[model samples]
Target: MKYKVCGRLGKNLKAGWLALVLSVLPAFVVADEPPEDPAHAHDPANVWFIGRGGQLYDSWMATTMAEKPWGNHPAYPAIGNKRGYPTWRCKECHGWDYKGKDGAYRYGAHRTDIKGVRGVLGMEPAEIQKIIMNETHAFTEDQLPHSAVEMLSYFLSFEQIDMDKYIDRRTKKALGDFDEGAHAYQSVCALCHGYDGKKINFASQKYPSYVGSVCARNPWQALHKIRYGQPGTGMVALSNVDLGIVVDILSYCQTLPEE
Candidate 1:
């Protein structure tokens, strides 16, 4: 017997095929999405959330949408007030380098004579959480939610990098291949910071703080920003990039004009 194709049957078959394709499309789309970075896979929170914690470390008041701690930070008189708003920032006292008075802020205007967070580098996240809530830090749940606290704690516990490996403290320079860094900068950073590395002046035009300025003045801060990105900005973290490449990028950035 010869089989004939019916119009109605053909239409039904077509509809069935369309429905099948639609059902399986999502799986393919999800498969194409990038996987979480393994570097942070062991952390209590995802890298992005931990990055938010880093933002909190920079300015908890800004990150949590809470008021700044009232009055001098209690330690203010000893550390001085040259840093202004940063005087209230964790980075101000501990240093953006995360080494506190023992490192970057050891003798500068940011000097506080306080110990660095390095001592707690590998502490448990939960333990770090308690430290923040303690009388010294005095952060309450009302100001920083449990989630925020967790993220911050996780960051402090696991995210601090050793600056000595990537930066030379004596010269305040990146310890990487400048040529390689120049290429990386041209490929990825030039789009935003421009060839001169002055497309964005993070500080006022009068002082004109560019990528070069940041690298020259604080290679540690530049390295941190390069690794994790500037919080709450369009800045993309080079977390996936090799640390050596990042060091190279920093080295190139140091060549830019500071003023």
Candidate 2:
């Protein structure tokens, strides 16, 4: 679908997160925040907790460079369809929407009765960290280091967004300002992604997953990568910026060349 600034999201449909996030940005340029010194984690610019945390959620194996777990996850149901490494991914059971059976994975091949991570949206990071290391989750010290778990917990506590609040579940469209979106992309993303967003092919030679292609297909996943840097790749992140700016970037991305 062709991207438009004032499309299906409607002028009256501005999300509160957009305004809320913009408030945190330094003159609307989140990337221009404080220097990369050994700063605190809460600092938006220094923080990779959100990005790396979410990346670990997407695939701990890739982000940690750890071996992908073989066979089904112990918690994964026997009735589920997938096998091997993929089943161990947090998104496999909980879903890209973080709403597991209750969300987009409710009825697909990825479907499982397992609940989503949304339950811990506002919980303390320490509490969530325990849950990750708990027997039910069964992540041992050897598998996931303390730092990795801490980052993942921080992401669960403060960084996760209610994607439904931003993108239309049906149309997968986002509300954004054209000029703002263009400026945001050119100022930051264009350096790596290049103008037209064709600098990289993330998927494969046959499918050719370019920036536009990803946004076009599974925008929820695209938004996740946009907010949190790509798994194990130094892809720039807007994890600390508000959801509005990122969605604006996404709306612009939808217009890129998919091939």
Tens digit per residue, CA lDDT, model 2, 41-95: 5685437665788889988988888987777788989768898889878888888
| Model 2 alpha-carbon drift over 4 Å, by segment | 1-41, 44-46
Using alpha carbons, what is the TM-score of model 1? 0.77
**How do the predictions measure up, each by TM-score?**
0.77, 0.78
Q: How do the residues 133-170 of candidate 1 rate in per-residue lDDT, one tens digit apiece?
A: 77886556777788888877777776666677678889
Which residue pairs come into collision in candidate 1? none
Worst 10 residues of 2 by lDDT: 30-39
